[model samples]
Target chain A: MTDLQITVNGDPRRVPGPASLLDLLAHLGLDARSVVVELNREIVRRPRLGDISLAEGDTVELVHFVGGG
Target chain B: MLVDGPFASLRVTRDQPSFTMTRLGPLIFASMSTTLEPTELVDTPLTIGGRHFRSRLMAGTGKYRTNQEMVQAIEASGAEIVTVAVRRVDLDRTKEEGVLHHLSPERHFLLANTAGCYTADEAIRYARLAREAGFNEFVKLEVIGDRETLLPDTAGLLSAARALVKDGFSVLAYTNDDLVTALRLQEAGCAAVMPLASPIGSGLGLLNPYGIRAIKRRLEVPVIVDAGVGTASDACLTMEQGVDGILMNTALAEARDPVTMAWAMRHAVDAGRAAYLAGRMPRREIAVPSSPDRGMLA
Candidate 1:
């Protein structure tokens, strides 16, 4: 599989091609249940993560609640 | 974040120590008893944006020594509504970093926040992401204008509140101690307006009692004082201003004993709220004797 360039949380990273959002999360060792994903400004629901494929130069943002005041 | 909104409530366990503590809480703070006074009925189940919360004090899950400590402190604080910030998950350290790993959303109603955003658009984005995380619609909207003080940009805050409210969010705006801005937030359809007691993380305590009181007096929605509370008295004083509730972090997270301080805060908030409802005695210029003049001994 060819590697494609993508942005995850604003940092450029290369991942194997033909990857869905769920595959991308797995590549990063992230549990899909724990974090929420936003691809190109649209939130990809957990179940739809596997359905949406990562494109070249896709902007992905993975977020979760952290400790803050 | 809790899967269910109002359904997630604190769980009661039969564990020995916690059980004893829970039972003793009433005896320790009997004056600030959960059972309301006859005149002051219906203080519990603080309703906001159609959600109900038993606690008026809300604790943050930040700056804690450890996750275990944070959990203990939050538990001790007796806060049903807890605030969490939305941020990009650190990709490098993918070890159970979510606050959810420690705090149970089932026990505490999660109130997501946009703590670090500086612009209205940025705050709105964060709030949307938080909502998409599949919790409730509540967001503690903050658009900080000053990095030094972490004071909110009233303009940005108002814009974000309006946008989020329009998007069907229960916007809980965190602003400064300004009645005009607070009123604007209320008008913007915020479920609750949170005015800071002082600068964020400053521990300067309640800087303007009258200002907070003014907002509480004018706003029809709940006015919750957030930030800058250093001690139990600070929490008490802020609550005594007639605000609906208070949300604090450093006061508990930074205390020598965060758990004890959290416990103190729980009592303080309850006491302050009760006092506000009970009302205070009028201040007199001259000394007034409790004994009657006719009963005074010659």
Candidate 2:
């Protein structure tokens, strides 16, 4: 299988092929329930995470709520 | 005097010790006396976004030395609502020991804000992300235009507010002291309009009380002074002007003793609300003596 290339939080990364968004989150050690995933500048709802698949050269932005004033 | 009737007899008498009225049978007699007493004003809870809050003071979690300090100050201030900024979660930081730990969800109603966003698109994106993180649709929309002034970009603010409201988010827009802009925000379905007392973190206090008063006069929604409060008196003055609540950060965080300052702010807000409800005396150019002058004897 060909290695998949993607950008996560502005950093380029290579991962195994045929991976789901949930797999990517688990690989990154992020709790699926705690973070929001933005795939290619579009928000992927939590329920749809399993339905979405990672492709070659996809841009992903992971965001969460932090302490703010 | 004593009066006799078919049903009963009534008697009225005044003595040095006391005044008394006596009634017989069905007729009841009551004694009357007069004494001057000060009138008290009633206290009313402030409502925002379908929620009622006893304290009209909202504190910010930024600028504190530590999360513990922030908690102490917020608790001391008696603010039920605390504003928080949303950003990309720092994976390096401990997930359980962040700001959320200090601010218990049961005790504080977290108000997420778009602080660093400079445009409507960015603000909207942050708002959505915040909602995705399980926070309710409550957001403090701040579209900052200039770095020097730290003033809000009204255009971006209006645009973001409209988008958020349409998306079912309860938007609280931080705007300038412009009455027209405040009204426009209200028309855009904002839950509340937060006008800056001055620039953000400047601590200038309410530089233009009349401008704030004007905004409060026209808007049906709650008006909260969002920024630029320097001290406890600043919060009091803003409340005295009839604003619903105040959202402040630097004023308490940067104080010599944030805890003490927080306590003072709580009192200040309450005092101001009381004073405003009690109705202040009218201003006069000529001096009037509080004591009687005509009865003076030489």
Candidate 3:
């Protein structure tokens, strides 16, 4: 289990990643359908979220969908 | 090159008489501002699939380096709606990410796109999966039957759109800039028609603005300029041409500063809409300078 340093929703958190992003989300309790996921600069497609593994020092940004116009 | 229009036969020269401008100025000005007039503005705060969108800017979740940047860029974009393609998170494993953890459904309107599907059936299957995965009614129905052009297979697109709409899915279709096809999709009860400006990720500006304009003229549903947008100017140009909104991906993600580009895009979308509302002066055959009447008399 490699150590990964990343920020989720702007708060820095240290987690074991080298794990797939899907696993990370599972750890964080995120739903791929309702939220938008961006890794590095590109969007991680909902299907690829679990396939895309995390490396050390990778930054993950999760945008939750809120009610708005 | 041959020019076509009312001025095609005008033997335009630097010193020609200002007859054209003098006669057509008022009419020209009126026509220019006609599109810009507030009354000409289409419906705003457009609602689709029980979701309300103010700016009509829908951004794709792709091609960024970091998640924070994506979030920051998205926040900067001022888009209430965003798109995410559905794919299996793990090709190695069978357990799906279940579409719940990527986004908090309560925050933004989620648009599920069938990006990797090639046929109508594949697209339909994916749409159902997305619905089952909690997408429910909202889906960006993309049926790309081709690989090279990344153009929508009109037959496939039409079939899938009709099927999805029949299945009670609110479909926002991604299509080529073909007026007839767009009409067909709109007539099929699509919530929106997202026509490409050029090819996907080509970064080409509106390849055929006339075609897009034609679609806008005929279609009652929101006409969003999707794909092939390279910069903010491209987005603005589409909005100026009277498109209701824009959906872009690569252009923003590839920028030196994705966040800044997103902000620029927001302003561009607004400016273009404002310009369209204010109407643009018609392109005259010759420059209509505000020269003195005495000079004209000479």
Candidate 4:
């Protein structure tokens, strides 16, 4: 298993093994219903988010959006 | 008998430069003789998620001091598509006068944005909440990963865009001005791509026309010039570069006169698009005029 370290919300997070984007979201405890993800500054569609695997040393950002006044 | 009324002595000036002055009298209007007509403007009608719009000028329903102002501004801007970010009908925030009371769904399409989420999953969750709150199928997918810059996390953005598209949501992805990143989002099936001119509230104008143009040229989806607009001229410049549309908030919202600025942007967009389609004459090393050569006798 490849060791993965990615920046989530500007903090470096180290997780064991290469994980799919779904796993990362699960680890973050985010409901698939309330978030959007960007991988290396590119938008990834939700359907493929479950399938796309994270590589070692990947720069990932997770964005959560809620309605504001 | 002289009647005292608003139009008591409206006179026609030969060339009143200002809009209000020019409208003082009934004058013969010319179609695109000097300034371009909105009807004859360039950039083909854009179809996103089955909604076809002739004008690419998009308006947002925010930052207006009054709802009446928003309505007037929307009409003046000639924007067919107006975006409204959905919020919980904050009844508590306004026990006497509600915040959501300012907007009406009958006027325009409500574009629900996940404004505060920190990840793709979080955005999706908000999207569902928005839909459940009766916002319909359209979502303005904004996956902002940074609070300081408010930049869309491309990884999270792409992830959310794909998810939303698959789940039957018409996603209008708000992205940064990166061609490669935009292409990836387009490939992920976003209904439209909205790229920022600069940071969200900077109003710095179009920071990279070439990059936006490249994205407009390469992507099959509509390219909307979103954010960082300071004036009508800025919007026009973007339209001239072949953008499908312009989405602005702070520029008009913070202008000296929001209504007038909205109309100015509308006309500027129509004029610039017409100029682009009419094709600008190449900039020459020397002046070239359509007149007989002065030194022909030589």
Candidate 5:
């Protein structure tokens, strides 16, 4: 099986084809409970992280709270 | 680590006499908690989005020199509703922990802000991203118009507030001290309207007291003064205007001693609130004699 290139937080990463969003987070060593995942501009609720699979050329954003006023 | 910082000092022995101020801070705070004025008794908890918060002072989690300093200062400030900003996790870095690593969701109600967004759509997008963090739906919405001044674009702010409110997010707008704009935000269904004390980060301190007071007077929602406070006096004076709360960032984070400054702010907020509740005397052109004119000591 060929690897698929996906955009994660604007950086390109290659994962095995049709990897679940949960798999992407686990591959990146991210705690699913801590970060919010945005797939193709739609927010994926926590429980749905593993249900949806990433497609080629998809953009996924992982964001969390930072310091601000 | 139980031997350093104000939090660690919470374990100080009860017998430690002549305890240093910072070393034994919580004891002083606990002792000072007595009610000299029943301001809190009369004032209900600050309610926004159907949630009640005990502390009227909301603090930002940015600009501190170190994360340790940020944690210590925020903890020292006694802020129950703390504001944070949402940003993409830096994937290139070895490890970039989010602010949640320090702040507990159970302790501090996390209020995320759209701090850098300049347009309504951008602010709306940021707010949506923030809501997905699996926290409460409170957002401190800012639509900055000018890069140099960092003043808000009220037009964009109102539109974003309306959009976010429609989507079920509790909007707390960061705007200038303008009554008309604040009223519009309230009409837009914002849970709270945050008027500025001065320009953002100017530390100018309540440039227009009349304007800020007017906003608080007219708006049904909680009015929180969001920026431009430089010191404890600024916090106190801003609170004296009878606003529901005050949110500050640089005033504490940029202080020479953030921990001590946070302590001062907590006191200043309470003092000012109490003074406001007690009510100040009307200004007089001439002084009146405390002793009667007939009762001269001579």
Candidate 6:
């Protein structure tokens, strides 16, 4: 199986095809409960992470709350 | 019997005293049981985005020296809602020790803000990301127009507010003290309109009180004065202007003692709100004498 290239947090990386968002998160060693995932400029809700599969060239932005006023 | 009047109620009793007393207004009746006190006045709770907050003082969680200091200041401020910025999750760090660790959701409502976003698209994206992060739907929509002024991009803010409201997020749009823009945000279905007292982090206090008052008078929703608070007096003045709430950060965080300043802000908000509700006396150009002039020796 060929590796698919995807961008996460502006960094491009190669991951196996037919990977769910949950799989991608796990691959990055991220806890699913802590981060918010945006797939191609759209937020993929937490409950749908496992069901939604990532495609090649998918740009994902994972965001979380930080110290801010 | 409860006899209703325009501003107060007259209660008549058939007891031995047989007198009438008016409550909740300036009307004083001759009755032994009638005692007027400021504590008797009921304060209306500040409501925004369908949530009732006891503290009309919302605080920011930035610029603190440490997370412990942030927690201390937040506790001291007595703010029920705290604003936070949304950024890319640091994957290298453990989630347990993140900013949320210091804040208890049960005690405080985490208000996620699009602080660094410069456009509508960026703000909208941050709003969605915040929702997905389980911080609920409360979003402080800030679209900065430039780096120097740090003023909100009114056009982008309105567009972002409309989009977020349509997307089912409770938007609290940060805008300038411009009345038209504030009204436009309200019309865009924002839960609240947060007009800046001045530029962000400027510590200038409310530079345009008339503009803020005009916004408050015209809008039905909550008008929160966000940003540019220099001290507790600024917060007090803002609240006294009849704004629903005041959101501040540098005022507390940059103070010599952040915790103490937070406490001061908390009381200032309460004092201002009480003063506003109690109704201030009309301003006069000429001085009035308090002592009686009748039968006074020349």
Candidate number with greatest TM-score? 1
Give the distance in Å from residue B71's predicted Cα in candidate 3 to where it truly belongs.
Answer: 0.6
Ranking the candidates on DockQ from highest down gives 1, 5, 6, 2, 3, 4
Interface RMSD of each: 0.8, 2.0, 10.9, 9.3, 0.9, 1.4
Docking class of 5: medium
> Which is the better candidate, 3 or 6, if ranked by lDDT?
6
Name the better of 3 and 4 by TM-score.
Answer: 4
Q: Is candidate 1 or candidate 3 better by TM-score?
A: 1
Per-residue CA lDDT of model 6 for A1-69, tens digit only, reads 668899988888898877999999998887788788889988888899999988999999877778897
- Name the Cα RMSD for model 3: 13.6
For model 6 chain B, give the 10-residue run with minimal summed lDDT.
B18-27
The sequence of per-residue lDDT tens digits that candidate 4 reaches over residues B44-109 is: 455788877656677776777777787788778867666655333222232322223454556555
Query: Candidate 6 docking category?
Result: medium
Please, what is the TM-score per model?
0.88, 0.84, 0.67, 0.68, 0.88, 0.85
- Comparing 1 with 2 on DockQ, the higher-scoring candidate is 1
Residue-wise lDDT of candidate 1 within B1-298, one digit each (tens)? 2223332422222213333343322212222555743121224457799876668899999999999999999999988888999888998777758999998888888999999999999999999989887879899999999999899999999998999999999999999989999999999999999999999998999999999988998999999999999999999888888887899999999999999999999989988876775567898999998877896677
Error of 4 at B231 (Å): 0.3
lDDT at A53, model 5? 91
For model 1, the docking class works out as medium
Q: Candidate 3, overall lDDT?
A: 0.73
| Per-residue lDDT of model 5, residues B1-298, tens digit only | 1335322212323333333433322123223445542111123467888987767889999999999999899888889889999898887773888999988889889999999999999898889989888788889999999999999999999999999999999999999988999999999999999999988888999899999999988999999999999999999999999898899999999999999999999889977875676568899999998877896678
Candidate 4 chain B weakest lDDT stretch, 10 residues? B90-99
- Model 1's DockQ? 0.80
DockQ of all candidate complexes: 0.80, 0.49, 0.04, 0.04, 0.77, 0.65
Query: What are the runs in model 6 whose C-alpha is more than 4 Å off?
Result: A1-5, A14-19, A53-56, B1-38, B92-96, B295-298
Tens-digit per-residue lDDT, B66-132, candidate 3: 6667777888987767777665344133243433344455765677788878999988976766665
Off by over 4 Å in 4: A1-69, B1-29, B32-43, B94-103, B294-298
Query: Comparing 1 and 4 by TM-score, which wins?
Result: 1
Each model's C-alpha lDDT?
0.86, 0.82, 0.73, 0.71, 0.85, 0.83
True contacts kept of each: 0.87, 0.67, 0.00, 0.03, 0.91, 0.79
Worst 10 residues of 5 chain B by lDDT: B6-15
